[model samples]
Target: MDELGIIEQGVDWRTRLGQDIRDCMINDILFSLQTKLQSTSTTLIDLQKVAARIEERIHTIASDYGDYLRRICLTRGDLDSYDVLLNDCQRQQASIRSSILLHQENKQGDQIVQAKRNTMGTSSSSVLSNQVALNDHKEHSHPYEKDMISKLPNDLVQHIMSFLSMREAVRTSVLSHWWVNQWTFLKSIQLNIYWFHMDREKFSSFLDKLLLSRVQADAPMDTFELKSFAIDRANCWINHAIKHNAKVLKFAEYGKWEPFYLDPNLVELSSRYLETLELTNVALDATIFSQLANSCPALQNMLLTDCLLEVEEISSSSLKNLDIIDCYILKDLSICTPSLVSLCIKNERTDNSSFRNSYLIFATVIIIDASSVSSMELLAMDRQFTFVEKDGGEPMFNNLRNLSLGLWCINNMFSPLRRFVRHSPMLRMVTLRISPLDWKSHLTKEHQEMLISIRDRRGLILYIDWY
Candidate 1:
């Protein structure tokens, strides 16, 4: 009961402390794995379930021995084995995350390639007919004997019909008299000339009938989309859409400048509730902007492509996202939207000088007053146009996080680019897409000047496209 007893007590205390340290380390590892698994998008549910199982196994292994010293002694090698297992799990997670990110990048690359093609309505009639056929299949695929779809409440049935194209939804009338008037209460109206076998008159007549059928219905038109090469009687169709209180209006047509000049009054009429307006290949006047500013209280997104904006300034209070692509007749594109968050300006001209004459070239000065804009992209075919900053000071792009410029801009406009870099304090990434030209063009004196300027600028993360 002297020196030997005291030494034995000290040994017991040390073993207990070591056991406690091992348990705490194991717990930390489990917690870290769980947190990481939760943050991941792919395999989250599966990984969480696996982690729970592993945690349970660890708990069982650790709790088997009541005495901490005894447990530490019994599973010392097992603890080392657990450490190896955890390391393997982390490595597996990293591999899975890498694979997922690679897959997403590949998917995004495919989408970018598809977007570059930009061909609209290839085989319009054929595609319309095929879509109708698919709808017909969906209509008949479910066996009525076991299906409760028909018995669903009117609102739910209406929701189901909303998923189908207007033609397919109307075809349901032939299925049962109970569904005869259901399509009349549709919240969306989408009309395509090809739906009537490319017969313009028939298409026009069908749309008139459909609109007339819904005239007395209590339903409001939430979305109205029209896709056609050109519609002779577009005025009547547009009037009906506005009268029905369309909240989202999209017209994709080829008006060819001379034939189509949209009525500015139309914008005024739908301004109360119109949240999104997208027009392609239509002509517009300066009055359109004034109408939008004065009337469109709820408008959030506006997209103009291959259209003529007879106005210099596009000022709106409610607009959040504005995308102008291939629009012309602008002396000064002065955007003054306070709530605007994103602005994208795409090519108004092409690389081929011969065909470039046909495109509507933008004005020289682009005056942007949207202080809230965080993401700005200027993707132009030609390296032209000047960005007019306020008061000639360090331009106030206070929250700008992403800036994308055409490669031609980087090659030619060194002063403006430098100003932009100085202005954007929070700039995170700069993406440069090269123009479709020979690499030899980038080796010119102008390119040398730009390279020198870029090198002088510090704290820029440049991302150049190799493809």
Candidate 2:
């Protein structure tokens, strides 16, 4: 053999020996990692068992404490303190359980990564080849794993898509062929212009296409929500939603100067199946309330936030829940909803001094007929607003059970608060929330006397919250 051939053979032999040594080292490291992982898994299982036992013990202790509380006569404050402690214990148990679950997931993930590393190794060439082989194996053997969501029933998938916003749901069409038309069948559609990363023209065009597709599909909308900054085509979209028999309608326009106003014709069309109406930063016509009362028999809940209300009365027979938050009332508004079980009116605008001043100046009085209202919250935390009867007669609340009032509203020598407590025959609880600023103000002897008088009433609980 030639000298060059002999040298080449020696070099090849050395290279093979080096590769064998490296492989042996890698095998030893893998074996050590596997042993440590098995030990860690065992420890985790033991820790999980301990956590379960601790949780069981916590439940037992809570039950024992609850029984002790029931056996002994305790003040409302003491009972509340005990309740808070019990809640903290329950929260701790939840935290421990969540930690255990997270540890289990992390352990499983680490095992998966270790197994992959053992199979692929540290060599770049081998890692790439193994990855390709793994991909091919997954594609051939576990084809369903690539598109597991598509395996679900059409109705189930559409129901899941309903939770996503209209833009997000539409984007899912790009995921797979099965998801292409799933968004069209969504019962709930929420369109927020801010979510769409497009210019006004594109957004409008996209919205038009989306609504047209739904219309063509003849899909019935259970809920339709539109949030935008004063879109010109809002009325058209609302008309489409109503045409599709939307049960819940939410329209919020962010333009403070030029708020979106509901079309009277669209309102009438929506009244047939409209169970809930939520309007934010919208301007209402003077006769909007009357129209809703007369036309919308299915309307059960209505929420108005930062809206411009140019109405005198809000009379709804079918309305069950009403929330009026920081709305601009042009005149004194009277609420006479016979079927209203819950009514919450909150005006807390400390940040916007200008809006607060305007709201206080323009929105003067709110007359409420709480004859059928079981739960009522009248909170004007930033300012004091008095609620009185229009006829100057004693206000009677026949079904007023739970009343929550802000300190500003009830701090006027407790005059309004006293009237409510006196007239509410079925009153069970009154929750008074005091702001930090108001907490500094000392209560007068008259205020204390009225508070004692109200608290001394039988079957009625007065809870004060200094927040």
Candidate 3:
């Protein structure tokens, strides 16, 4: 036999077949890697397109509704929803960018493996060893190359986490060892039922664990905002926040029928650092308000919306801004804050006639003692304008500079405007927001003539808003 024939006969047929099968498997794997690379590239392109569209939409919203958005944010504090959307978009973009980088690295790895297979004579074991070594080296040298956010400073990462809801913030712990427990240091703790997506029991347990963990960590609680269904542990959470010297405390109940009542003992707890207190759909008694007025010396801003107030008076010395909207007052309401700078009272009722009759015939009168109030807005369109000064001697708003009134009848608007101008010497602008239900009365020739006469005679700036 010839030399090649003798060599072929010396090699076992089964071994040769095994080697052929191994080579074919390696080729298949390389082909699969190439296909994956192409797929990843396509996915990257699609993600880029999605990201570009999202950016365009965001820009359009900002440009088209900037003023309207500002108004809403200033009046209702609804900016958190918009912020959540923006943060989610940003997180998606970051994840897509990281995925693209990881795919490119994987493609490079595939190219290296293919090059090795071509030059190294298809020794599968040797090729895999080399690839493993290369991967290990890259992993050790640049662990966070794919995830750039991991390389950010801890404080910046914590700041980013602050914008996320409590559940989302806690979920970051599973990303890697470096992220473990990083969310525990967040200053702003926002717990909303919509974020948890859990039953009441699970939510309560999670909340307890989260709060306990933060309390153990001694994390600074700058803002503690809670929006949820009425829970029994809510009082405990509020006490914890107060104990931690929370600066801003907001508690809103989502259930309209089952209103959350503040624990009377909470008012006894001294919140020396509490600057803002906002309560919605909560029931409050007179003793709680009286205690809060005395206990929280730093309290400057207070907002109560859709609340059940069994209190006759709200007295606070350090309050700067107060807003009471659509609250059910069981008796005559009195506000006697001395340091108040701005006050807004708004009530939007469905049955205007009945509400007007009930409100007026109940002999309920709103008394104000805020002499330092500069800006005032009273928007109870159904009720007649009546405000009694505390001592009944001087104008209530001695420092009032701006006044906005929502009037149901434009013909009767002149009297309130004249009275306000007479009482408020520093008042420079009066904005009359005509109620939508009274638009017919707003466009009358007599009303326009009266407005002109008031402006000409009083030398006051009048802005008529028909909405």
**Across residues 127-204, which tens digit of lDDT does each residue of candidate 3 receive?**
222332222122222244565555889788887887886555654543444665666668987776544331344456
What's the CA error at residue 8 for candidate 1, in Å?
A: 99
Alpha-carbon shift of residue 118 in model 2 (angstroms): 30
> Predicted candidate 1: what Cα RMSD to the true structure?
28.8
Instruction: Quote model 2's TM-score.
Output: 0.62
Please identify model 3 stretches exceeding 4 Å from their true place: 1-168, 266-269, 348-365, 382-385, 389-395, 408-414, 436-451
Global lDDT of model 1: 0.59
Compared with the true structure, what per-residue lDDT tens digits does model 1 show for residues 43-123?
312333333333333333332323333433323323232222224544665685576555556665664534322222223
Per-residue alpha-carbon lDDT of model 2 for 188-301, expressed as tens digits? Answer: 877665433212344465567667766777877899998765355677787777667889999887532234666565555436788998998786866677778888899999
Which candidate wins on lDDT?
3
Worst 10 residues of 3 by lDDT: 75-84
lDDT of each: 0.59, 0.60, 0.60
Query: For this target, which candidate reaches the highest TM-score against the unseen true structure?
Result: 1
Candidate 2 regions off by >4 Å? 1-168, 175-178, 255-257, 265-270, 353-368, 381-395, 408-412
| Candidate achieving higher lDDT, 2 or 3 | 3
TM-score of each: 0.62, 0.62, 0.61
